[model samples]
Structures are given as structure tokens and as C-alpha cells.
Target chain A: MADNVIIEAPMPGVFYRRPDPEEPVFAEEGDDVDAGDKVALIGVMKSFHDVTVDTDGVVTEFLVDNESEVEAGDALLTVAPS
Target chain B: MFEKVLIANRGEIAIRIIQACRELGVTPVAIYSDTDENAKHVRLADEAYNVGGSVARKSYLDGETIIDTAERADAGAIHPGYGFLAENADFARAVEESECTWVGPPSDIMEQFGEKTQARNLMAETGVPIVPGTTDSIESADAVREFGDEHGFPVAIKAAGGGGGRGMRVVERDDDIDSEFEEARQEAEAYFSNPDVYVERFLDDPKHIEVQVLADEHGNVRHLGERDCSTQRRQQKLIEETPSPALDDEQRAALCETARQGVAEAGYVNAGTVEFLYQDGEYYFIEVNARIQVEHTVSEAVTGIDIVKWQLRIAAGEELDFDQSAVEPRDAAIEFRINAEDPSEGFEPMPGTIESYRPPRGIGIRVDDGVDEGDDIAPFYDSMFGKFVVTGQTREEAIERSKRALDETTIEGVPTTIPFHQQVLGDEQFRRAEHSTTYVEEQLDLE
Candidate 1:
């Protein structure tokens, strides 16, 4: 976990790699992220929101599976500083 | 009523207002934050628009942006559903001055009720029973101590501009008064930007009860009934039910009548709630919520009245069609707030995507939900996602049905208080209606 920053779930909801499964993910492993890059889509009931990167980094690992449920504070992805 | 009304809110309350608009044949325009682009309320509205960023300060709380959104959508009225800018007199005036009908009380009335001391004085002058306390801010510790001594021990030191328990301190004994008073004042300054505090006689083992009232432009005001909201943690109600078991027929009637008189005296029009604390067969006024309440569904279930629609009608200068005797309540109804919070962990907010969600539905069951199965519960907003309202022919039946409904309900991705509510429904004390305001903190073992 050295040199890696984990993007955690801020609330309880379902995580989506993209807006829909057919669409490309906003961010993926090996992709670079600015401070506010859209990372993933999270859904709770009928409401949907874009999860954004908190700091500049490179996506190192996808810690959560696509469409998987994530709780607040749960790790979703790990980002390594470029 | 206006052909279109903008609902400047999100979540179940917004959805509830939209439903009312649809029933009244008024177009509902929903404004969403960046986080609520695909919210249930947005999808359910006749028209929806993106207001601003995810932060409430930039979106829902931005009165100019919201009113502008309403104008762009051709909405002729704005229904601020509780919180955000609901009680903000400035926002109400802004909406009214913009040539848009505000589906609430007049801005002048709101200003009077928005001030704690002024509202208290008004209620007292109208013959409304208020908790024995100060009519003005306490200037010194000696004053607070004197008031406490006069009112007896166990006084509540409260910030003049406070609600939601932020700047309130309950001093149970004489020794704790000085320190608690200072702490309460500091908290008031830090939170509400007002250090002025007041003292009120604290009721021991009181039941949080409120009367649902509706008023129209034709000088008509009537109360639906009483709701017991005693099951609260941290001063926020988790469950609410109409026909408070703590109140007998006489007490209930008197409480409701007093609330009606208080609102009428204030020249308030539209849907509002008069809150009270009932103890030892007596009811004392606490405050008035100037908009629709979260527990309104319970009253609706029992009364079959569309409160939001009446707000629109009243704002449109229509008189209340039904008088006090004509509005009939047929049964008992209860509501449980479904929030994305882990009840086991001190009810800490658990904002995340709801992986799998299905609300229980059947006869006498009504769900006002703001999210679907896959929508994300945003951390930047209130944790509540929806409400489950159930009605039955009797209070016992409603309680039993509530347990069954909770059992059938399933929400994944985050922990909820469903199990806790189930336990509460079956608890002997709760079943017997013996619990008080402190029930959730003192009786229930959340751990």
C-alpha cells in the first residue's frame, strides 16, 4: 500500500464503473487523475452521483468490483502518486 | 393554484410535494444539485433542472439560483419543503417579491415566527400554553440561576436562535447551571452566530407531540390530529405516529385546538405543525415548523388529506374546502424514516450506493422514497433516503403491521434502522406506549 492513496466510499450505495455498463469507465487503472477527475458513478436508490478524485495520482488498483455495494469509508480504489 | 410550482428540495419530502402537484394538476419543477442529477424527485417531476454544484450552499440554499431555475422552468410558485430555506423569511420574501407565489405562510408572518423570543411571546399572548421559562434572553449567570430556581431545578438553557439540539443544554441540578449555561451560549455563538441564551423549565419524561394544522386565505384554520414523536435520538425523530397514546381525548383536543388558535392568531396560512411537549397530562408549546414535516405522511395516511396541495391552493388564494368537522381521520398511521446510517454503530451516517433496495408494499402501505435501487446516497446531504408509512384500523394493528413491514423490507449496501424499528415495535414499553423522549437513548441498547 506504499505510495498509494485509497479512494474510499463517502456513503452507502452501489458503485458503477461508468454511468452504464456499456459505457467506458471515467477512470481506470493506470490512468492519471487530477484533483477533481470523475472516477466512478455511485448510485443510492434513484439518485446517482459522480465520485471524484481527491488528490492528483495514478489509478493503481480497483479495490471494489463494478456494481458492487460500498459503504461509507469503504475503500473503492487505490491511487499511487505519479 | 399555479400551473407550475418549483420544489426547491430533494429526497422524499421533495418527492412527496411533487406527488401533491401531480394530484392537483399543477406541474412540478424539480431543481437538482450535481449530486442529484438522477434523483427520484427529479425523474418524477414534470420538469427538472440542474441548479448548481453538489454543496447545498451552491444549490438548494442558493435562493437566487433556485428562484432563477423556477423562472426558467416557467414555475409560478415555489414550495420549499422543509429545511434548507423553508423557514428563511428572506427567501420567502424573495420568492413573493419575484412575482412568484410562495406556497407557505406570508413572509411577514414567517419573520415573526422565525424569531424565538417573538414567536414565544406571540404564542403566549394568544393563550397558547407554553413551557414556563424566560420571555427574553438571560443576560447573566445569576439571571439564569434565578430563573432556574424560580422554575425549579432541571432547566433547559437554550440558544435564542437554536434548533436541532445544537445550542441546548439540559441542566438537571442547580450545581451544573453556571457551567452548562456558558457552554450553551458558546455553542450558540459558534453554531448560530448568536451567543444569546434563554432558560426554560425542562419537563421530565415528556412526550414529544405535535399538532398538524392547515390554514387558508379565507381565515379557515383546522387541526388534523396529534402525532407522538417521542422516540428520538439526539433530538431528531426517528419514528412518528398519529394519535399519541400518551394523550387522552380531552388532552388531545385541547392541544390541537390551542395549536389551531396559535396559528390563526399569527395570521399563518398553509401547512404547518405546532410542536409541544406533553407531560403529566399537560401539554406545553415548544415551537412551530413553518413547513411540511418529515412525519407528515403519517397524518396523511390517517386523514387522506393532501397537505402540499393545500399549500398550493392557499397560496393561490383558494379557501380551505373542508372545515374542522368535515376533515375526518379514520385510523392510526405510523412512519419510519429510512436512512443510510448504521444503527449498530451509534447511527453514524453511512453514505454509499444502495446495491439492492426494495420497499415493502401492500394495503395501507405508502412509501415516499427519493432513491431507487442503484442510486448513490450522497454524503453531502441528509442521510434519510425515504419513509415507510403504514396505516391500520387500530393502533395495535398499525404497530403489528409496522413490524411486519419492517420484516419484509430489505435494503442492501448500508445498514439501516429497520431492525431497530422492528425491535421497538415489539418492545413491551413501546407497545404499551410507555416510552418518553429519552426512550431511544436510555432504553434501547443500540450496541
Candidate 2:
């Protein structure tokens, strides 16, 4: 059984899946990510802050939709340790 | 007239602006965060858009996002009601540079008055009496002590970019000046992003009086009398009333005149407020609030003028229809701020779901609020849920009416400042109008 870890938003802002509109998503479901891998970005006050995953895991699902408003501590995605 | 006007704000003031737009036959557009999805303003507006997250920085303060929303919604104008980006010169300039009209004073005027030292200097140049202090920012604590030595102790070291008593420190003696000055600078930097500070002689037991002024592009400026906001706790106003019982007729006329002249000299347009500290029959200019204030309702009630509607009309290039002589203040009016705080618990914020909410209603009473029963008072924003205003023919009548209205109000699930307001109405000193700015902290013990 895989150990599931929920990734939460570090700050309150609009959660974006990609770095820019023309850029591809940093990670997707079923992709294996290393420790300290960038998973998302939170855009607020005219700036974007990187949201990174700490532990090595496989991205299982995105809990919140792309470009959705999120609060601090709100779950953004779910990851299973590989 | 604008076909659609976007209100870049939330809460009661947003509702107020929406109503004004409706009366003017302009569509109202609302922008909300995640927490304010079900807010009253959102429901009332003709069009609503999601701005950003729950916090102000992500939503209300995001000028680029707000402008983009206005552009997407095809709004012809934007009304920034009071807080958030209302006083931001950059946001004002952005709106100016955009297709949407900015319903506020010119950006240059905002920049001039945004800094306290600059405002003081402008008022001084216009012959408006200012508090004795440095007209420029002090570089070190030694500068503060030197000013104190000349002006006496109990001096106030205030942040140049701060207002509403956020970045102010009062040093009573020589020993505390250095520490207070450093603390004031740090707090100012943290809050206003500006570490520059200026020193002024702190007046003891002074009346907090402010004059409302309206100016148009046609170069006409008029004063809308004054309001006494002396009932304050920790420099936050709890109650405000017009035709202050403390000022005589002669003094009131002079104060209003000075406010008009000072703003006109600065080339200020649209609605603004000039605040003053009055003591011993003398009034000194303090600062200018370049945006519409929360207590503007009090002045509107007494003068029979719709200030919000006028703000829209002024922004649309309308001249002042009425002159200063037409601005007549009739009956006395008082406004009570009903905030989500427990007065008994030292006014700590107690945000929660309002299980039951019933505001007072009847003749000589008006209630302006943003929440309904079963609505959650989010901790992400200001704790003020409503404002109750009462008006009567005389000051005594207004006071009595306020007591009756407060008693009739009901709220559950969260502690309110209603109890504190009740205690104040029943106090003899408050009844006699003997209270000053420090009255709430000194005379009344809520515990």
C-alpha cells in the first residue's frame, strides 16, 4: 500500500498549475516527482510564489482545479509515496 | 453616464456604491474572493466576478487583476469604496491610464496627501494651522529628542505613510523617546512599506473633528460641515456624531472654511476629508483622508445629501449642483459601529457565524450592513459587520434615539460592540458631550 500525503497551499492566492500560460504543467498525475520538486504556483499581489512538494512521491490527483482561488492550508493535491 | 460601474471593494461600502449606481441607471459589477463568494454585495450586483483568494493581497489589493476584471466586464468606471486600493496612487493612476474612469481625486493629489509630512507642509503653506513638529522626515532618534526638547514632552512620532492611528507612538518622557522612535519606524516599515517618520507635539485630551469636502473638475469646492468622532478606543472610533456639541457656531464656521480653502489650494478634486485635533478653542490640521470615510453616512444624514451618489456624479464630470450655502446641516445624527468583537474581553475579535441577526428599524433610524442571519463573519476581513445611524431634531433626542435603537438590535453567535455602545450612551459624561478622543480608554471600564 502506498502512503498518501496531501499537499496544501502555502499561501492564499490563485493556484496555477503551470509557470506561465504558454508553459506546460510542471507535474501531472501518475508522474514521479523527487523531493523539493515544484508542483504548483500561488499568484498573489502581482507576484507568483513556487509551491513545491517535499517528499519523493507519485502525483495521484489534483484536489483543486487550475486557476482556482485557494486559502492557506487548503489541500491542493494528493501524492502517494513511491 | 457610465453604462456599467465596477465596485472594487467589499462589505457595506460596496453595497452603498451599488445602490448609488442602481439609482443612476448604471449596472453594478462586483469582485469577490473565495471567502466572499456569498457576500451581500455579490448578490446585489448586476454582474459578479471572482478576483482571487480569500486574503486582501490576493483579491482586493490586486490592482492588475481588478483592472483586468473591469476590462473583461466592459465596465466604464471603477469605484474603490474606502479601503484597500482606494488611497493607492498607483492603482488610481492605473485606472486613469485605462479605459475605465477612476472615481476619486487625481493621482497626483493622492500622492501629495498620502505622505503625512507632505500633507502637513501643504496645509501649512496654505495658512492652515498645523501641529508644531518637523515638516520633514527625521533620520534618527536624536532628531526626535531635539524636537521634543523644543516642543516639550508627550510628542507623537508618526509614520509618514500611515493613518487611522496605525503607525503612531506617543512618548511622554525623554527616556522613552529613542525606543519609541525606533519602534515607530519599524512598525511603519512593516505596515506602510515606508520607514520615514515625523514628530509632532501630542495634544492631550483633544477632540477628533473632521470636515468633509467635495470638489469637482469645474474647480468648485464645498464643505459639508464637521463630525465629532471623540468616542474612541485605542484610536479606533466607536461612535461619531455631527454638529458636535463641543464646537460653537463661530468655531464650526471657521473650521469648515479652513478645510475648504486648504483642499482647494492643493487642487484636490472629488470627495475627501480633512482631519483636525481641537483643544482649548484651537484647531490644528492633522491629515487628509483622500478617500471616502466609513463615517461619511453621519454627514449625509444631517445634510440631506447623498455623498456616494455625488462621488459617482463628480467622477463623471458633473459640476457641484449646490453651493456651500445649500449645504445645510439640520438635525443631529449619531452613528454606532457594530463590530464583531467582545468588549468585555478587551475588544478581542470574535468572528463566527451569525446565527441570528436583527437590526433596529423605525423613524429616525437607518441600518447599513453587509451580513444576514446564518452568515459567517470571516476573520479574513475587518470585523465591522454593520453601522447603525440615528437622527433627531436635537442632540439630546439623537442620543435618546440611539439608546432605543441599540436596545432593539439583536445578534447571536458572536460577541458584539453593542454592549459597549450601550454603556457609553448611559454614561453621564458622554450624555453631556464631555468626552474626548481618549474618553473610551480612560473613562469607561468595560470589564
Candidate 3:
């Protein structure tokens, strides 16, 4: 748990855990994820950008609320080694 | 006509609808997000209600909340302008079931045109030429390849449930089909909540032409001519104009008639736009925008028609009081989208407060904006805050006037698309009408 990494938003916009409103969240807390897996998306200017995980880990916690405005470098989630 | 109408949207379009309602002697009600407490729309509205939080899903996209606001305001009709819930057939259906009338096409027609594949099929059945593509959604890359094999490479995979360039990808070679198709599918799922996609022969270079059609509930359909939206980057239009320089008089008549017939056959009503892609000498029906669009003002300027006013009238069961011949667009017009994006920084969104705002004014310029000086530009919404529509006797005159209008226009504090528009207006190729849909991406430096 000490070796954890926090992912941050690359730009400003609304962040979404689920791909769309009705779809299931890409990953939930305590769920295992691999590198290159998209955990969320940053919605901006009628476009969507995938926020992919950079390392294999278990999602420890989501740091930001879904569909909330997020700025660049804002902490999105915390991940620990699986 | 409605005694009062609720506008279930925000920004310049909301203002546009409010003006229309006022002109028709109807009270205009407005809705706002948490960040839009001081928005221009709220100030201009006879009554304003807060929908929800800053995020669109919590606010403007909340159909039930908007409907509730309409009820609270006692508005007789609801106008969903351009975006958010504008083309949502489910929302329109809900409005139909409610006490308020929906000020657009019927819910069934919206649903019909909302699904891209069904639209293509319907247009084809109605004798309108559709782009060479699948009338059904494709399931895999192999199916797309089959289409590419028959129609050739560089095929466009488009979302079946949405338009306006989202969830669309162009696969240039057979080797890139699998990856591109997957990306398009994922985007389709992300945006439209549906992964269904269809393949089409991607015209390498085509002029984007759309006809403005207004159909009354009584079956009178009139076309307000076509606009050439050729100057675009990444399938997003930057500038649009009517009486396409590329089309001759015969082609223009044929295209307008085609759109009118297509919508008439589909039993469409209210203000809608029929979009097409024109290449060589042929034009193909792409899709229909079942609500008033951003570029509708250009058509309005030339034809001297108040399309939004007509939307209210038609929704109230009034017949179109004019004939197709009487719907003559005398002059050419061009609309420039004033967006809060930096041309220097690759046209990136730079939303902030407008320290000072002054739109151009003169003989042939009309400005539709949602913000004034000192107003904050919300990042959560679309980048476009306003549009500067210019008209003149001919395309050359319109271009000349546009350069002056754009120069006279001034928006302080945030980076804008003005510089990019200014550059395009100066370009010889653009002035002479030689650009296509991919013109901006291939040629201009966005300076």
C-alpha cells in the first residue's frame, strides 16, 4: 500500500468514471487493472479523452467525483501494486 | 402561437430563441447550470430556473429537471436549441406526453433521423442519393474491409446514433482498418452510448453542403437554400456560407429540391437541416439535423426569414405562409463561429472571463452572443460563445465584408478563433472557393 501512485488529469474538463451515462464504471475501487487500461475519461469541448492507467495495480480509491470539473494535475485516483 | 415558451438550453442559441419568442409576443423562460447564475440568457429571460450542477449531465442534459422547470414557469412550449437535449427523441417524446408542446420535429421523426443508418435508408427509399455506405450497422472490421474492398480504401466509419463528427474515423489503408474501426466503436460507445457503427466511402475531398429546411405540420416543406461548410479541421466546421461557390445554379436547385423532398417525404416538421457531402458533381445525403443549427443564421440573413419564429409558429400548428418560389435567398451570407479557442495554441480551448467584448456592426453584420463584457466563459460548455454572420450581394462581396467585420470584431481576455478566421479570409484559395472539408487540416497553419 505504501508503493502507490496517484493519477492526475492531463487537462481541464469534466471527468467521468463510466464511458457514458448508462455504462458501468471502467473500474471500481479494489478492482485490478493493467497498464494501458482506461480508467476514466476527461470530457472537453464536445470531445472525450481516455485517462489510461500507466501501471498494473489495484484501484485503491477514486480521488475525484464523477462528472465533476477537474483541472490539470488534479488527482484523479490512487492505485497500488496488484 | 404559444403564450410562453421554455428554452431547454443555454448560450447564444438560447438567446436566439428568446428573441424569437419575444418577437412572437411569447414570454421566454430560461434554464441555467450552477455556473450560469449570471448568464446572459438568465438575464434576458422572463423567468429563469436553476437546473443543477456545472457538469452538463447534471444540468442542461437533465431532461426531467428541464421539464420540471418548464412546468414551474408555466411555459406552453419547450424549445431545445441545437445541443444537449435538442435532438434527444426520448426527451422530445416526454415533452409531447407533458402539457408543453415540443418546438421542433415530432418525436418519431427525430428518432427516425437520430439513427444514422435508418436515416440513410429512409433517404434512399425517398429517392434521395445517399453516400455509398451501409444502411445497417457493421459488427466488425472484416465487414468494414468488405466495404472498403468494394468501395475502395479510405472509408469512414461513423456512429449510427450520433453526428457532428464525434465517433467518426477514417481508415486510409487496409492495414489500418482494424485499429481505426475499434477506435471508432469505442468513441461511438463513449459518446452516444451505442457502439453501433456503419461504413461509408470516405470522399477524399468534398465540400460539406447543408440545406436549411422548414416543414410545417401541415405538410408544407420549404428549403432556405444550401450552405457550404467546407472550411473545417478534423470534421469540425469553422466557417459556413450559403450559395456554395462550387455549385452552379442547376446544381443548387437540384440539391435544395432534393433536401426539401427528402424531409417532406419523411413527414418532418419545424426547423431542421439536411446535411450532405458534395464531391465532383454529385451530392449525397449524409444526415439530418432535426433541430435549429448554429449556421441557420446565414440562411436567415439572406432569405430574410426568421427560422426560429417559424419553429414556434409551426409547433403551434400554423402553416408555412410562403411558397418555395417566394423563399428566394437574395444575397450570399457567411457565418463565423466566435469560439474561445486559441489559434496560436493549436486552437485549444481557453475559457475565461471576457474582459471586454465588442462585436462588429454595420450594414450586413449580425451578432448573436451569449456573453457580454466581464461575463465569465464557462469551460464546461461548448467553446463557441457567439457567431458573426455577414451578408452581401455576392460571395466576393461577402468575403470582403467578412474581412472588415472580423477586423472590427474584438473579444478580449481569452484566446479565440478570430485569428484563424482572419487568416482564412485572406487566403486566395479560400476566397476563390477551392477548399474542401479537409482544407483547414491540410493547408492552413491556424495563424
Candidate 4:
């Protein structure tokens, strides 16, 4: 079986879909990604932490929305193994 | 009584308020910040509303938005559980100005007691012994030194308008007065938005005791004995217990009476706490908490008094049902504040996924928690995950039970104060009741 990947939040924060609202998203559905790739940025009270993909895969669907508040362990994106 | 109450807080307190509402047969409507969508409080409540952003200013502290949500949910009263907007005088006024009732004290009473100096002056008039200090801010280090000489050594310089651990300094000797005074004043300005500082005699090795009092609209007021909260770090209480090990029967009676007299004189109503610092044989009045306290569960555990329900009843214009003598605290109770902090690393807040969490359960152990096993401990809000409250037949039994309870509680994926609590419980000084307010800091060397 292919390694089905799930991107999870590294910390509790507001999940920003893109670096900026007007900018293009870092990862979207069907986007190809490798291990250690940047997936999203999480904004806490005053600091921003980044999330990365753990396994090489093609992004299938975004589990969370842009600027959605999320806790640690919340899924950010789902991916199909390449 | 209110048919529905909106809990304007998050975390353990929200869960606590929700439980209270349920027991009273009132619907509990909980408001959650963006960070708290899956929080335990939200799940436990009758109805949960999304307030706003993860930041407290945009969510929990957004009084207008919260009130709007309350109206939309048709809540009859608002309970601002401790912290967030709990002690905010303006928030209390806003609730009262709205159609709904505020479950704590009246805003006016809050305003009067919010300032430490004002409360000190008010309580002094009622013959409640207060720490010998200047009423106004000491303008300079020279002023602090002069006050210290008159009051004797070890003077405490504190911000006139400060609470928590901010803007406070204990000048052990005359040489340290200038630097400590300046640091305290600067911190006061930075944290509290108030730069004024005052001086007072600092008692060495004092036990922190606070009396829980409740008053109703019908003019009935009573004290619920005293709680010893000497185990603290950075002025934040880590553990609290009822029927202070340090106080004898006479001292307990005297302290309770003094607190009642002080509250009566202040024209206070509703739930409140009169805090005092007891040193040697005398007790000195500290400030008053104008809202339900986090440690109130310990009092309830021993006294069988549901404080939150009474807060609602008192706000609804009902008289307190019990008399002073009618209230007798049985057994001994202890409360451990479980904060998401790395106790090994200077107690820095360690917010992360709970991964696995299991609250201790057994006879006489009650857990008031805000997060589940899979829930994340949000760093955006207060670090307190919950509290472990335990009660037993005697102080020793309570201590033993508390130790077992702490050992049984397992919180993963983040450091917690559990280890510190375990160590404290096992310490010889604590077991022997030889610990003072400075015990934790001195033993840990937090400073």
C-alpha cells in the first residue's frame, strides 16, 4: 500500500491557507510535494510556526480552511503517496 | 433564577460553570475562541457559540461580542469564570447594562475593591488588621527607604494598582531597596499600565489564607472558613487546601470573622474572597477577589456548598440559605493547579497536543478539566489545563490522597506542573506543615 500522508499541525494556532490572503497557496489539491516540504504556517498569539509534510506525496485535499483556528494534532491536509 | 446562563470563558472554568448550570437545571451556553472549537468545555455545554479569533482580545475579552452571542442564544445571565474578563469591572458593568444579569458581584462593588489601596483603606475602617504601609505610591527609593525604616526591615514595595505576580518586590535590606523599588515600578508600568508603587512591612514566612464569603440581595452574608494557598510560584498559586494546617481553631474563627466584617463594611454582595497573610500570630488583610475563585472547589468539597449555584441565586436576588454556624467544613481538601508548563525549564509554558490524557479518578478525587485526551492545549489562552481537587477525612489523609491523585494523572506531549506537585508533596517540610509562602520559591530557587 502507498504511504497515505496526513499533514498535522505542529502546534496550536490559526492555520493560514496561504502566506498572504491575496497570494497563491503553498499547497493545493493535486499538487506534488516531497518530504520536509513547507505545507502551511500556524499563527499563535504572537508567533508563527510552520508545518511541513512528513512523507512524499501528492496533495489531495485541504482538511482545514484558510485562517482557520486549529489545535495541535488537527489534520491540515491529506495527501496520496506518490 | 436564570433559565439559561452563558459561560463567557474557556478551559476548566468553563467546564466548571457548565456543571454548575446543569446541576441547577439551567441551560449552559458556552462561547469559544477560535482556538477552542474542540475544547472540552464546548463539548460539555448545552450549546456552544463561536466567539471570534484565537486571541483573547478578539474572543473571550470581547465583551460586546460575547453579550451579543448571549442575546442571540437567549441566555438570561452571564458567568465570567475566573480570569479572562472575570475581574474586569467594565465587563461586569457591560453585563449589567445589558438585559442579562452578571453572576458575580455588582460592578460598583468591583470598582471599589479593584484598587488595592482603596480596599485597604475600606477594610482598615472595619478594624481588619492590614499590613503596615503607606496609602499612596512611594515616589522614590528615598521614600521607600524612609517607609522601610519606620516599618522596620524587609519592606515590600508593590504597585498601587497591581495584582498577580506583577509589580511586586520584597526589599530584604536597606541596600536592596533602591534597585528593587525601581524594578517593581518599571514592571508595574509595563504589565499593569500603572506606575505608582507603595511600600509595606514584609512579613517573613507568612501563610497565605483567604476566606470565601457569599452575600445575597436580601442582606445575608457568611464566611466559609479559610483556604491555605501558600504553595505558589511567581505569586500564582500552584496548590491550595482548606482548613489551613497552620491555623488553629481560634485563629480560623478570628480570620473568618474578620473577613465577614470586612466584606460587610465594603458593602460587598455576591461571591467574593477576603485574602489575608498570616505571620507569627497576627493576620493582615490583603486584597479581595471579587469573583468566584479557582480554588473554590476545595471549599465546596469540604463544605458541601455549591458556590457557583449560590452565585447565580445571589445574583437572582435570593438570600444565602445558610448561616455562619450552620456552615461547618468537614474533612480536608486540596487543589492542584495543572498548568501546561515545563517545570524543569523555569516553568515556561509548554503548550502542545495532549496525545494521551487521563484524569485521576477514585474516592474523594474530582477533576475539573478543559481538554480531552486528544485535544490540544492551546498556547493562545491561559496555560492551565485543569485542576485536580481531592478531599479526605483529615489533612494527612488529604495529603496522601493528593499525592496518589497527582501520580495517577497522566498528561502527555507537553510538560506540566505535576512533577513539581509530586516533589512538593513528598517534601518533608510540606508533610510536616513547616512550609511557608516562600517554601516553593526557596526550595526551587525560581528567582
CA error at residue B348 for candidate 1, angstroms: 1.4
The regions of model 1 sitting more than 4 angstroms off are A1-82, B134-152, B156-199
Q: Candidate 2, residues B1-447: lDDT per residue as tens digits?
A: 899999999999999999999999999999999889999999999899999988687899999999999999999999999889999999999999998999999999999999886898999999999988786899998888788889777788888887767889888764667788899999999999999999888898899999999999999999999999999887689999999889999999999999999999899999999999998888999899998999999999999889989999999999999989999899999999999888997776655789999899998998899888998777667788899999999999998999999999999988899999999999999999999998898877775
Error at B158, model 1, angstroms: 6.5
TM-score of each candidate? 0.80, 0.78, 0.83, 0.79
Give the lowest summed-lDDT range of ten residues in model 3 chain B.
B172-181
Candidate 3 per-residue lDDT over residues B1-447, each given as its tens digit: 789999999999999999998899999999999989999999999899999999888899999999988987889999999889998999999999999999999999999999886898999999999878897899899999889889777888999888876878988764677888898989999999999999988898889999999999788999999999998877678899988999999999999999999999999899899999999798999899999999999999989999999999999999999999998888889999999988787778866789988899999999999998999887789999999999999888999999999898878988889999989999988988999987898876665
Residues B1-447, candidate 4, lDDT per residue (tens digit)?
789999999888888888888888999999998768888888898899999987677799899999999999999999998988989999899999998999998999999899877888889999999999897777899997788778777887887777664667888664666677788888889988988888888898898999999988777889888999999876889999988999999989989999998898778999999999988888999899999999999999988999988998888888887888899999999999998877887776756788989889999999888888888877676678889999999989988998888888788988888998888888888888887789888864432
As a whole number from 0 to 100, the lDDT of residue B245 in candidate 1 is: 85
Interface RMSD of each: 8.3, 8.4, 1.8, 3.5
lDDT values for all models: 0.85, 0.90, 0.90, 0.86
Residue-wise C-alpha lDDT for candidate 1, range B1-447, written one tens digit per residue: 689999999998898888889888898899998878998898898789988877676798999988888888888999999889999999999999986889898898889888766787899999998889886899887887787778776788888887766778888764666677788889999999999988888887889999999998888998999899999988889999988888878887888899999999888888999998888787888888888889988888888888877888888999988889987788899899988777887776667678999899888799988899998777667888889998999999999888888888889987787877887887888999999999999987665
Q: lDDT tens string, model 4, A1-82?
A: 5866777887667787677657898888888999888878987644567788878889888988777677778988898887
Roughly what TM-score does model 1 have, to 2 decimal places?
Answer: 0.80
Q: What TM-score describes the B chain of model 3? A: 0.89
Residue B366 in candidate 3, Cα distance off native in Å:
0.6
For candidate 4, give the docking quality class from DockQ: incorrect
lDDT for B75 in candidate 3 is 92
